[model samples]
Target chain A: MKTKTAPVAVDVARPRPGPLALLAGARRGRRKLGRRVVPYVFSLPFLTLFAAFFFLPFAYAISQSVFKQQRSGLGLGPPTTIFVGLDNYAKALRDPQFWDGIKRVLLFGAVQIPVMMLVALALALLMDSAVIRFRRFFRLAFFIPYAVPGVIAGIMWGFFYSPSFSPIRQLATTTGLPAPDFLGPGLVLWSIANIATWEFTGYNMVIFFSALQAIPQEIYEAGRLDGLNEVGIALRLKLPMILPALVLGLLFSLIGTLQLFNEPLILTRLSGSITSHYTPNIYAYNVAFVDTDYYYGGAIAVILGLVTFAFSFGFLRLTRRQSGV
Target chain B: MRNWRHRASLCLALFLGVASVLSACSGGGASSGGVVQLTFWSFNQQITEQADLFNKSHPNIHVTALKQPSGPNQYYPKVLTAVKAGNAPDVALIEYQYIPTMVSNAALVDVSKYGANGVKDQFVDSAWAQVTQGRAVYGYPQDTGPMGFFYNSATFKKAGITHPPATWDEFAQDAVKIHALGPNYYITAFPPQSTGWFQGLMWQAGATWFSVDTAANAWKVSVNDATSKKVASYWQALVDKGLVSTVADFSNDWNAALNKGTIASWISAVWGQGVITGSAADTKGQWTAAPIPQWTAGAKTSAMWGGSAISVIAGTKHPQEANEFAQWYLTNSGSLSIGVKEIGWFPSNKTAQQSSDVNAPQAFYGNQVVDTVFEQAEIPTTWTWPPNLTAVNQFMGDDVNAAVANKTPIVDALDKLQGQIVQDMKSNGINVAGG
Candidate 1:
């Protein structure tokens, strides 16, 4: 029961140009070639960078993870790199310190990620409201922390946490109140988390705030028509609209928390609790450089990469499934 | 589609072109007029000045010395990576504890062929022993930190201590007396981060943390053996009694404590006087030096903490010239005098140690001849620094510092570290003998 469709009138009444079809064909050929080449030229810079820095390193690390550097006798000669298959992976898995680092970072994320997201969302919502004053100033002030380098921020917080250098500690002791040791074994993790939260909360707020800004005014009108107040409109309309931003923020924070190094590294000078294996990234670093065993470090790095990929992929798929259903 | 192929080909060509241009900018040093150029990398500016002097003296061989980052945490990785990449300097200053690791990696050249053994008689036995392994000489010892005891005379006077503690028992008793002066004061600080200092203490107690078996081609680790555990327990008792503060060495708090008379004394190497002088500005004339307290009543045994040697890197084009520079840097009176003046280097060269410049009273130690204290020290020659010492130190810093912070037995930490060190060496394909 297929019906025959008529040809377009323009195709039926097409006229030949004065230059004829041969010249037109040549011109079209050049145009097609140009169209094919132009995009590649535009993308050459970024594509080169991606291939060199990111893709090449990922490939090299994976390759190195399969090999072990071995030395014989007194180890006073050149080392030989030999194939060990999955032995490196097995070794990393069996390492108690490596697992301890992962467990510690996970514990840190469980407490830090949720608290950070809520604070960001609340701040973004507060800034979005009509009653908010000094909007530009507030945004800049909040974002300034993100602009500060992580090492510098960690050092600043380290000084603040130190019993000797901190004015707050001195003041507390003078006022007859014992200043709780912020770098103590029990509180060191939370202290690091506070530094991380202070650094990234503003960045997440910007993401959520931008998403809030993107929502049309008509959505608010629709909520108003449903007899909803401003708070209800924000809760019912704006909040759900920025779910993608929230998920993105959570994903980035999780990844960052797992790779914690600079903060704990700077704080290590102040606290005895932060070990060489305080975080997985730091442990991998100590293994590679401090311990000079790049094979094991490479294996640890690959394992961490796989775990992060699994988590991120699973999260995205789960969110999509829920939204679709 | 064929045009698409052309596009990809063009893109790849462009990438290669750009990469070549970027890499070209990293061209190495080139010499002119028959001069052989050598690059020298070290953490101290004094080394560079010494190199400059060498360049002036040697007309045919030119050297460009670079001042790298300080501390083991920052400097070691840079040189190690440079060695791997074959971009390493012709010469590098390596610490005695770290040289074994470098030798294991083949980053250092064997200077034995360059007649490094001929001048062995010029160096102290302890310094000479560190740079030589089974007759293969790696480098020349620039300096050695013979351990000593430094105290605040004012603080000692206030604590009613007549003289410096001459034995471990007396040190402990004096620590108690100093702590009794006030709640704010302690005899000294047992820095949590300075595992090298602890290792130095163990060495003084006659603990051979490492011993080599050439017949079996294996390393025997005794980090937590009887001698070491004895030293650890002694320090642990002091920590438990709150007779010593556990502040990090050279930290702002430690400096403040030293300045404010809270921490009264420091048990450190000869170079520690430099650290104290650099940090504690207000306590200039109040400081004095003494020999490290003995475990047995009359033991003169001492140990090293932070000192370095000059090694010719494996990839150097001018090995002979590089070795010559290293030798001169270590043994030359001119270079040694400059080091003594500029960076407070305690010469490992026997003749240089007797030079007027070295024997001259250091104003920082209240114009006292502090070398007498350090020179009298007799460092043991049998103790070997293992190739895995760097990792061992990190483990000590972590486990030992944890124990120190948690108010637990420090000997347990040492035992844990001993196991970890052996395991680390074995995993690295080094021969570790016995469990």
Candidate 2:
């Protein structure tokens, strides 16, 4: 019995030495090396670009926001940059024009986003329905405006908004109706909203339609088996299925509405309604480039960026909780 | 092993792509040669033509003229960015009003260092004053936009008005008589967006809104001074009375009004004659030129509206060559003649002003010697612009436009303009007084 026990104990004490153990060790080593190197290799280009364009500029802008370039006396000599912590931010916060710009954009977004999204969703739903004809043509036609650049689109819409040479005004006059002053101060914001809706609705529609296509056929079959009609299915099943896309679309539109710049910039010369400080971005741009007050502009930009981040993060958090994502 | 090789190749490709992009960005310097290549940026077509002429004449120096967009909104930002990056053109065209801003920013080199002072007597005093900061000359005067009145002669004739109004009171009376003709007709269109023109009117009224104290090195802004208020109220009354239409200048509606005989006249600069002729071509031989109507009777005072100077940017590699080109292009009789005759840029040079090309009658203005009217209208008036004049002007435009839209009183607008200007100047680190 002692001899048998000693042989068993010696067998257990000896380290495992076989082809299977050796192969497992080699596999473990390979996976460890891969775990270390694979992510860097995959992310190198993106990381480089991100660091160069986004991170570096963002860091610089933050640093610049704390400094002020002061011109002494007559401002004839070169300006001297000095550190003025929080002064620029304080000034921006106190500026009426900046607040006015924020209010204008908020008001614009409030009315524009709902109308734009509703129209986009309706078009996307129609295109997705079996009752629709020439779906591809309609999709392509709707998406074409997104292909046109913002500045060019603004210019094209500006022609229709012009009181002097507008074809719409001509039609109104010929029809014995009062020619609407589209570029008048009272109506210009709506005109700008119209341009924004025209430009981005098509883009959002495509996003929604693509999302709608991804809905499983079995789900539709199941809904139909329960006596759900096309509209009923679309309202209950398809809409819920595409809620993530809708949220994403809403976030994009919200960010765009906050950062309004190009349309007002191009419309400045054509209409009196658009001022140099028409929107926050325009105001920051004027302060930075036009006024040559880089510090103040940087502060405004940082504040605006923070506001955007807060809004987006808040929205994402809310949606995540609601959808249990 | 294959995957590693593929990754290596991808990394190499990205490196090459980045290198190529960097190389592309680093391009655009003097080519490796004996030739001195100078880059000139201008919004004026005449400058491009003249640059071509210079290139043909001087083989040692090659100038590449790049055309920028005309408006300050597009062009000024590009210039400012280039100036900041130290990659600005050798020579650039700047409006006279922006000279102080450029000077304060130290964006222009004193051209007097390159013998610019020698041609000081060649340009009009006001034009010369615009290019000089204290004692240092910064640029060569390119063109002058002496203010003048462009009237529709047929409209005046139909209204039984024999002569042009010589004073504001007579102008107002004529506006009433012209408005009585029909609902469509008015004496003139009061352009709400014409801040420069409005400033010209204020200047003619002896209103010096901005002045520099060289000794103390301070800027004085007096935007809502008595003379300016008088000018504002005069126009405000006319606008409120519906005697004048509040149309924007250089707009399609304005041109339509001019062509349709609804707007009888334009109190515009010399450059406006060319614009009117081009835009209202069908009204040829019906237009006439006169001095801008005065605030005081028999007063010969006038003010400049739009003019520009060719300035050498501060860090130009070829400053001497740029100065040479600027001097030659502005003062040379041959080049000035082309600028005046072909391009219709009213010359600032004395010789160019006296040239037969400028003195010749324009058929569009019914054989009127419009250039002579413009030349005679260049009176000695105190016109000063602050370093933050652009900001001040923007505020002024907003207030004035508000007044025009009837959202605010003209006096209130002027008061707000004054406060905003002072506040803006102070915020921009400028010394301000008389707030």
Candidate 3:
């Protein structure tokens, strides 16, 4: 039978490969399609939406930033809207208030981000600790402030900041402590930072806790075997593992710090301390609505957007380089 | 087959979601049982009360009132945006200062179409001027906020001052006397919250914010001119003298100060009667009304401040009902009485102003004749606000506040303001000359 099997395999080539070969090729094609086309098909919707909403508007804003409306004479008789290349950007660059806003935001970022991040990280670690009791209740309690809308939060904080109606001021007076003017130039930024932290610390804490949870139990077990304590594991393993989330939180906080408006605006209304051009967003808003310069406002918005993008990208790159990732 | 079924279900879910979202975004109001639901927005108390009264009388119509967040600076932009989005209210309450913007934007209906039949002609001439634009009557005069002075009688007594001053010099002298009594206290209120108030002062001094060339339709900056400079410099001196508190206007501090007798007098309009008398309940009978201090000798009788008008949106479905309600509410004797008594709003109608309710002494102010006092201060041919007065007010107010805060010098600030305001007016496509 062995000798007969060798003789049967002797005919290796026919005039053409028969229906079996074609069938095999068709099967391979189906497999290839399932592997490649299916994934692309699944991803199409998300890509489409991103392109439509985010990318399109961003492109439009960048384009609009380069142009300005220059009106001649009385500016009453059908004023011409001409393209003055880079003039809008130049004007924005030269504006001292705009630069001052940037400097203020930078200083705000320097103080606010680290303090808020550290607080959020501590909260997350505490929440994630196995020793912690009533974890669900604690989790919700910490996150309650995040559930409030920004405008509503601003309004509530505004009342707190108001010297006349504030319970804090009342308490201070009763305790014989000087009621620190939250809206004053010296304290306005911190007051606003407090509001920001109140708003987003819980949200960021939840993010960090989620990232902590995602770390493998095996890694912790390995750490235990290596004689690392809980604190040691958190510092060396857990924190590092969650670095991406921390970085993301920092980026988000930085962006929010730049667009500081509602808190200052509401505070200004509630108190008398915040000025009209207190923040860049407020400056842009006053320019558009109060000053009726939608064009200039548009330019300011574009500049803010670019600055945010640059910051986020630069931050990510720096973190990547530092981590050697 | 199972995979196909799952895919089909997914597609169906997506389709339904999209349909629902699209329908929600594009949905128009459906008339419920032959009743037309009309949305009405108002910032003024008197105008809103009128709308509510009209709604009660008309069964076929339903009017919903949406109160805007405070400040004319916030109101008009929201209204404009809503109008552009085709979601505007049928009836809107607009301040007189914003009427020009509305008219220029073509957002207002020509109320003149209804003719003079039911419309009252007794509104003050300046009030009527604010409502009318070109050949079209944009709105009915809802309330007349004729300028006046409200003084804390206790503070006046403390300063040993008798009779409210009639001229700027006398007012300054009174302020000096009041300042002698306290460090931060002043004889009058200067609002950092409002640039229009400053403009009103300038106009009282016979100065304009801008000069218009009618033919060219361009507005030139007059903010740095002699008249405006003089007014700004005077205010600066007041700030320097430490008579005027660095505390800006319309703030809790300012309001609280008023209650605490920190501000001796507020140069306000008739509507301010409500704020002073209502909020500071303990200070009742301690307040009295007088004419706003004139800028100098030979200034006009008075100027308008913080007044509102009632306008119908251009694309409203029920024009007749809207107009009828507007007219009946603003001009009717009963509605006007409610405004004065409940809300402390001044009646815009000439006949309504003559009502016993309007002429009655308010109990809060120790029987001070606020109605009669403000009535005498109504000046017909005075300052006219540009359509973009809101813009101008904001810029000027900001600069004034900046100067007060020592962020910039008064002259430099005014110069910057002049430059910025002109640039802004042009960008907004406002006839710079006329503005």
The candidate scoring highest on lDDT is 1
lDDT of 2 at A65: 93
Model number with the top TM-score: 1
Query: What does candidate 2's lDDT look like per residue over B1-435, in tens digits?
Result: 688899889887997797688567655536447778888888767677788889899887888888888664457767876887678888888888888888777788898878998889999876798788778988989888878888998999899898999998999999999998987688998776677888888888888888876675677777788888899889888888889988777767788889977799999888888888877888899999998898778877888887889999877888888888878889877788888887788888888877889889888988888888766664655567778766766777677776776456777888888888777777668786543
Q: Which sequence of candidate numbers ranks them by lDDT, best first?
A: 1, 2, 3
lDDT of 1 by residue, A73-172 (tens): 7776678889999999999999999999999999999999999999999999999989899999998899899999999999999888887888878899
Q: Model 3's CAPRI class?
A: acceptable
Candidate 1 C-alpha lDDT tens digits along B91-209 = 98898988888888888999999999889999988778888877789899988888999999899999899999999999999999999999779999988788788888988899999
Residue A45 CA error for candidate 1 (Å)? 1.9
Q: After superposition, how far is residue A192 of candidate 1 from its true place, in Å?
A: 0.8
DockQ of each: 0.45, 0.39, 0.25
Give me the TM-scores of chain B across the candidates. Answer: 0.90, 0.90, 0.88
Candidates in descending DockQ order = 1, 2, 3
For candidate 3, what is the lDDT?
0.74
Worst 10 residues of 1 chain A by lDDT: A8-17
TM-score of candidate 3's A chain against the true A chain: 0.83
